[model samples]
Target: MKPPDGPDFSARWAALRNIPPFLRMVWQASPALTLAMIALRLARAMVPVAMLWLAKLIIDEVVVLSQSGGPATLAGWWDSGLADTLLVLVALELALAVAQDLLGRAVSYTDALLQEKLVIDISIRLMDHAAGLDLASFEDASFQDRLDRARRQTMGRIPLLGQVMQQMQDVLTVASFAVGLILYNPWLVALLALALIPSLMGEMHFNARTYALNHARAADRRERDYLRMIAATAETAKEVKIFGLSPWLRDRYLTLARRFYEENRAIQRRQLTVMAALTALGTLAYYAAFLWIIARTLTGTLTIGDLTFLSGSFLRLRGLMEGLLSGFSRMAGEAMYLDDLFDFFTARPRIASPERPLPVPQPIRQGFRFEGVGFRYPGREAWAIRGMDLELGAGETVALVGENGAGKTTIVKLLARLYDPDEGRITLDGRDLRDYDLDQLRATVGVIFQDFVRYAVTAAENIAIGRIEERDDRPRIVTAAERALADQVIAKLPQGYDQMVGKRFARGLDLSGGEWQKLAIARAYMRDAQLLVLDEPTAALDARAEYEIFQRFRDLTQGRTALLISHRFSSVRMADRIIVLENGRVQDQGSHAELLSRPGRYRELFELQAQGYR
Candidate 1:
């Protein structure tokens, strides 16, 4: 479903509701820093009014001294003690100025620290929440967009913390100015509000429009970023160059970027036009109030100090009001983004361990059984695997063979419970797979898919990820590497197990596809799980290497249940049983020699590959 073009009016105000929770997050990030920021800002908020009042007093005193005709010379005035009050007042003003600067710096320092803490806190939360979601959630396009927005919010919404605090500070400052203005004339304060109200409304409307534009373009922005990455990244560089795709990618990025720029420019243009006119109205009101102040002074109805204070107060109040209004609107817009972050947190995994989950059984009894299982990927119409009955008996080595899109990988995912079957049930030792603790069940099964991640870390670290809890166990890492025959590949590297093995980082060594496959295979061994799955684990290796790897695999997994997926008939020929899948169902199951002896899809595929070898 398409997201709304933008939030509506009520939605904009409702977004404000997010601020309280957002502040709570900020407070949680660092309570001491949060409190320090508030205190510093509150202290700074009163500085402006105090300084202005002092200026008024100084001016009034100077006027009185000049009119009194005290002394002819500065020395004479000072000796007579007439200039004493002026001297003390000036010194006090200077002190206040210094305090203001120090407080401003303190607030700035505190804000910076608080913002960093909030970013880290929010980023960690986003990572943890994303990790807990079901694998299917990551596959959905809509979910991807939401995830993207939420990820952006980790850094993007951080400024809202400072903005909120500043808004509060501005509120206190505005209240102080308003009190002084009301003392002179309540109508002046009312007039200022009337003038600024239009400007505030204009700001709100435009900020809402800006937010809507960005929200609608989230998917486009993601695609643009992807294009940007593929055009320049090491992984895609070879393919991009070979295909001569630079122009296409550049044009696509430019198209999306241009649209974003144009939409932003349009909103900015309208905001400029409307806000400028409203701001001019506010200027007129300030001048009108200035005229009234001067008239009162001329009539002797107000003292010179009153005129000075009232005029300065009016000007400051106008600027403060404008800032408060605009800042509030911007904060509201930012609060809308908070919805994305909080909404992401609200997403709970559909596949979770049951309450009072049973511990996963050790030393398998009946092994795994899929009874009339049916499954489909999220947002997909056709089933990936349906009405399938399969089993991996204890101590049995089984292989799954199929054409492309024939659900070989789907079977592995279902066995690992990356996704739950939509129909029927999958059981382990007569108990439903869902009945066991999710983490424990996964820990019991080790799987290495064809597209395993080539991490930009030391070779040992890459293997250690399989059972991260045992990352520090050097002996285990080495043993796993030897079992997968990855030790031979690592031995050639200058730093052996410690060498970083990806082109993504500098001072890193890139490995060949087969070598990387060897490293990936080591991860499975590192797990030492009860049920092992190698899905196209040797795809990048030659026939000779593939045969050697499987030869060792069969020996290492002799008494453990293993499921293998491979297109190479040579690799599966040694398995105790081979299951052939067609569409989403098992078509046949037998020993390789038995299948080859029969006239079936399995035999046809075997002959086709064998002819290639011949």
Candidate 2:
């Protein structure tokens, strides 16, 4: 695959602008913890400069005491106390060391807590945003890449908060040390600034390159993650073992991973070389300043205390400058990654309810009518369904029959407003479906597709997802399950309603395909929707189960609208009417008996199916 293009310089700068908002989000995660962290950092920030100044004092005091003929023995020194200034300085240094250790621990503790809260906040927001997106967005590969990058930011960029806080603390310490150096000789400050300029620019350049590389490789990273999941997860374990796919999957993973490694290695190699050269230049400037300080002391132009303070400050200033510069680059890179997160959050769902949505007509009087509807999936040439006109009346049972990919499921999708028709409108009671409140619309139309998710939760909770607020209503759950014929299956479980239904969790009771299908069908009944749809959800059921379920489907869906999509003519024959679809257009429509007597696609298909029994 071709490598994706990297973000331009303008894009990188735009990403940087997201920092303030990102920091605001972090702070908002936990106000008290965030405040505590800031306060602790401020205190810790001044400690380094204070400790260095105190060291200078203690060194000078020792020299003065020795020259003044202080007590020789330890006991005499303690008793006479002539070395009191030295003793006091020594004690103060020890106290400063102890204070620094305590403040450091507090800052770390606060940071860890803040990180935890921020992760939770980001994860929740990510899930909520993803939930609001249109189904089409999830189907788009580019959107998936963006989502993958956004997901990584929740946990991967966590240390960014601490890094920024530390950078702030270091800035203050550098300023404090710089002031002391300036009082001695301002030229030294200038020399130190000049030395770090090269290194700072180098770091920024390399950081930008790294961000570009990561941005370009988003799709590749997503593929690698998918491959890894397929190789390791229980969901694919059966097929993987039967086909002996382990080696092939491993090799494919290695090929993709190695490509990423090679790209990253090239960037790292250049960064290493540039950083080394810059470090040598900084070291040269440091020693040059060191010699000048010694020359000033030798010529009687400076005292020992002044020399010690200036040299110590100069040494510290260089290290701090280097740290501050390097830290700024790392922070910029992290902020760039936040672009993905903020971008995902800011994405507007195209299928959202209108601002002034019309209330969904209760009892759905006129039912749903598709008027010359046409739809094409994104990036596709052929329409999934086109020029289709159909009506599903209230209290009617309609079966949509067709070959695979004959737009059977697409019609169901359009009815549920999962995807609006591209070329025409679908209206309910003479009002466009788009005018109805989206949530209310979905709630009124319950659909169970062939590929319905088999949740790994408890049996009761799984069915309860249909009407989540009524999950605690045991009577309602039991009623729905009984209607779907899943009650008998669940009643035999070791824990019954409380039993976990998938193999994902420990001690979970795995059910057969038919049993799982029955459980899924219950969710639709649980909804008690005005319009209930089953799109081949019972294909896994045995012949007897399928026949029995459809025989009672009308009573199960009494006084409501129903649309069933199935290839089994035996099941299709139970509907009040059957519509045959071919090549994204309806070919025929009638009762099963009427269709059997006609010379058309429906008659052809019905006869073909009947031949299997003969």
Candidate 3:
């Protein structure tokens, strides 16, 4: 799908609508910090005007002292107390300067702490929300693009917090300066506004264009990140070297990054050109105001003190107004990113449990049954499974034999409720699967697919992840490991069960394919699940090892319902009933011997394997 176009002028202003919600998240992160920051900023905001006003007072007092007849020497004036007022003014200005420094430090410290808290809070919310979403959402290309944008916002939008606070503080400072400016002549304030309005509009337009460019490039950025990962990561390093993929990966990354840079550069160039011209207009307006102040002083209509005050206020106000306008435009652009985060949170999972859910059956008496079930993955026209009917009788060991894409793994996924069927119903015992509490239903089943993760954690922790609540139950962990023959693998490690596995981290030892397979299988045994599904679980193991593992599996899971998927006919022959699947439907089913005696797909496949052995 084509990426959505960038926000227009109206949309940029509309993005400010996100500010309130974003502020609420900031407040939610830490109320004390938010309140502290605001209070400190308010105090700091008034400092500049107070300091400027004091400078005018000190100047006026010094002028009076210099012109009036008084003690000629410094000691004579100090002794006579004639310079007391000027000294007091100087002292007050000194205190204000010191106070400003202290307040500035306090604001920085508070802002730093608050930024960290906000980042942690937003990150946690993102992880929790993503966890509750449907698995299909992660698989969709557009959804992934949105997710990438939202994830970037977690860190990328943090500065918006300080930017917003700074903008607010600057507005208050500008208001104080404007009050003084208005007393002299309101037209000076009007002229400043007239000059800056164009600049503000220009800034807002360019910021919106920049946001639009980033929004459209989310996919390219994600691909670039992926390329960077594959080029150097531990998992891909070996293949990268052997396949000579470094140059190709580097070129692809540069290609994407260069396009992004060019697009961004174009927007920045236009902004620089337009904004520089507008800024020159503002500078001209400031000098015009200065000339008016000098003329008033020369005419004796304004005091020298008044001249100093008016000119200083005008300069500070101009800079503050410029900063306020530009900062606001940037904040609005950043606020646009908050839409990605809020939009992600707004996504609701379609496959969640009902409000009132039945408890999953303890013993799973009748096991699971799929009734004319049909399902297709998101963005695909071809159904992964269609009109599929199957049954797993309680306490029976069923073996499914099928080539890739014959719906073997899809059936396992359906049984686990990772997805609901697009068309028909699935049931546990006599009740609809959807009627059962989703979590409870999943807790009752244990599945170990062929491509299980090799976690970068201790051997024991890796196995414990299957049923994490029992992680501390050492005996159970050990027993499960021994049952899967992973105990032998762990025993060879430097720290035994505590040994960190996977080469992803330092001081970690990697395992062979067969050894990793054993560890993965151990996770299935860690669960106290009634129904166990093993999909090509022994593919990494040698023939003798596979036979030994399955022998132990059948012995350990004697009364539990089990479903096994494998291409090796030798393994399926041990199942009480073997199912042959073709084109997403069950083609044949019977005892291994029964199927082999007949001229069917099962017999044909067995003969092909047998011929390979011959």
Give the better candidate number (2 or 3) by lDDT.
Answer: 3
List the lowest-lDDT window of 10 residues for candidate 2.
1-10
Model 1: lDDT equals: 0.91
Winner on TM-score between 2 and 3 is 3
Better of 1 and 2 by TM-score: 1
lDDT of 2 by residue, 1-614 (tens): 33334455456556668778878998789989988988998899888888888888987787787787877888898899777778888888899899999999999899998999999999999999899989989999999999999999999889888888899899889999989988888988898888888887787777777777788888978888889999988889999999999999999999999988887788778779999999898899999999999999999898787788888888989999989988887787788888888888888888879999988888888899889999999889899999999899988999999999899999988888888899989999999999999999999999999999999999998899889999999899999899999999999999989999899889788898888888898999999999999999989986668878776777789789998888888777888999899989988899999999979988888789889888
Candidate 1 on 412-499: residue-level lDDT in tens?
8988889999999999999999999999999999999999999999999999999999999999999999999999999999999999
| Candidate 2 residue-wise lDDT at 598 | 71
Question: Could you estimate the TM-score for every candidate?
Answer: 0.97, 0.96, 0.97
Q: Residue-wise lDDT of candidate 3 within 1-614, one digit each (tens)?
A: 22234678889899999999999999999999999999999999999999888899988888888899888899999999988888888898899899999999999999999999999999999999999888889889999998999998899999999999999899999999999999999999999989998888888888777787788788888899999888999888889999999999999999988877777777777778989998999999999999999999999998888988999999999999988988888898889888888888899999888999999988778988889999999889999989988899999999999888999998998888888999899999978899999999989999999989989999999899889999999999999999999999998999999999999889799999999999999999999689988899789887678878877887889999988888888876789999889988989999988998989999998999889878
lDDT of 2 at 193: 85
Identify the runs in model 2 with alpha carbons over 4 angstroms from their true place.
1-14, 73-81
Q: Which has the greatest lDDT?
A: 1
Q: Please estimate how well model 3 matches the true structure, expressed as its whole-model Cα lDDT.
A: 0.90
TM-score of candidate 1 on Cα atoms, chains taken together: 0.97
Candidate 2 TM-score versus the reference: 0.96
| C-alpha lDDT of all candidate models, in order | 0.91, 0.87, 0.90
